[model samples]
Structure formats: C-alpha cells, structure tokens
Target: MDMRLLVGRNVKRIRTARGLTQEELAERSGFSQQYLSDLERGRRNPTIVSLWELAQALGATPVDLITPDDHAD
Candidate 1:
C-alpha cells in the first residue's frame, strides 16, 4: 500500500475513534478542514513535523500515524 494512503487511513481511523470530525481535527491540528479532508482522501504529502503536529492533535504518537493496520493488505 502507498504510504500516503496508509497515513490517511490511520488519520481517519484515529479521528473517528476519537469522535472528531474533520473540522474538529482541523481546529485541534491548526490545519484547515480542507487540508484534513485532502489528507483523509490521500491527496497530500505530509512532512515529519506535520505528522508530529497531527499526532499531537489526535492524542497519538507519530508512530501511530505511520503504522499499518493489520487488516490492510
């Protein structure tokens, strides 16, 4: 699987698990809702610092964002 797509999936998974909407995540992450939406759709490439920031917003570690789901091929 593509790394970008993997990260996107992880982001969406965590966000939903935390009961946060894209807009809510955007507010917490200091990123625009559009950006989060694009990211969830696997349309943007994020930097490591960005991953860190996003992870903090989601109350997760950077490794969580990069880790692949077991059910993912």
Candidate 2:
C-alpha cells in the first residue's frame, strides 16, 4: 500500500476516534481545513514538521500516523 494512503487513513482514524472534526484538528494543528481534507483524502504529502504538529494536535506520536493499520496485513 502507498505511504500517503496509509498515513492519511491513520490520521483520519485517530482524528475521528478522538472526536475531533477536520476544522478542529486543523485549528489545533495550525493548518487549514482544506489542507486537512486533502490530507485525509491522501491528496497531500505532509512534511515532517507538519506530521509532528498533527500528531501533537491529535495527542499521538508521529509514528502513529505512519504506522500500518493492524488490518493492513
């Protein structure tokens, strides 16, 4: 599977599990809602800094965003 899609799915899963909307996550991550939307859709490649910010915002570690899902195997 593609890394972009993997990260995107993880981001979306974590975000939803935390009960955060895209707008709220964007605000917390200091990014735009459109960017978050693109990210969640696997249409954007986030930089390391962006990933760190997003992980912090979501109360997760950066690795959590890039790790493959348990169901991926």
Candidate 3:
C-alpha cells in the first residue's frame, strides 16, 4: 500500500474515532484545516517531526500515526 494513503487513513480514522474535527485538530496541531484535509486525502507527505507533532496533538504516538490499520488491506 502507498505510505501516504496508509498514514492518511490512520490520521482520519484516529481523528474521527476521537471525535475531532479537522478544524479542531488544526487548532490543536498548529496546522491549517486545509493542510489536514490535504493530508487526509493522501496529498501530503508529512515529515517525521510533522508526524510527531500531529500525534502529540491527537494524543497519540508517532508510531500510531505511521502504523497500518487492520482494514488497510
């Protein structure tokens, strides 16, 4: 699977599961909502530090951000 899609799905899944909106997450993560939207659509290639920051904002770990989901296949 494409790593971009994998990470994007993880981000979206986790965010929604936690009842977080893109705007809210953007505010929390210091990223724009548009950026998050692009990311969730697999249009963004995040750096390690960006992933770490996003994970921290989402109350998750960087590993969780990068890990493939069971439904990822």
lDDT of 3 by residue, 1-73 (tens): 7778888999999999999999999999999999999999999999999999999999999999889788677
User: In angstroms, how far off is 26's CA in candidate 2?
Assistant: 1.0
**Poorest stretch of ten by lDDT in candidate 1:** 64-73
Ranking by lDDT: 1, 3, 2
Tell me each candidate's TM-score: 0.93, 0.92, 0.93
Give model 2's TM-score versus the native structure: 0.92
lDDT of 2 by residue, 9-65 (tens): 999999999999999998898999999999988898888998999999999999999
RMSD, every candidate, angstroms: 1.1, 1.3, 1.1
Model 3 pairs in collision: none
Model 2 Cα displacement at 36 (Å)? 0.4
Total backbone clashes of candidate 2, pairs 3 or more residues apart or in separate chains: 0
TM-score of model 3 relative to the true fold? 0.93
Off by over 4 Å in 3: 71-73
Q: How far out, in Å, is residue 30 in model 2?
A: 0.7
Overlapping backbone residue pairs in candidate 3 total: 0
lDDT of 2: 0.91
Worst 10 residues of 3 by lDDT: 64-73
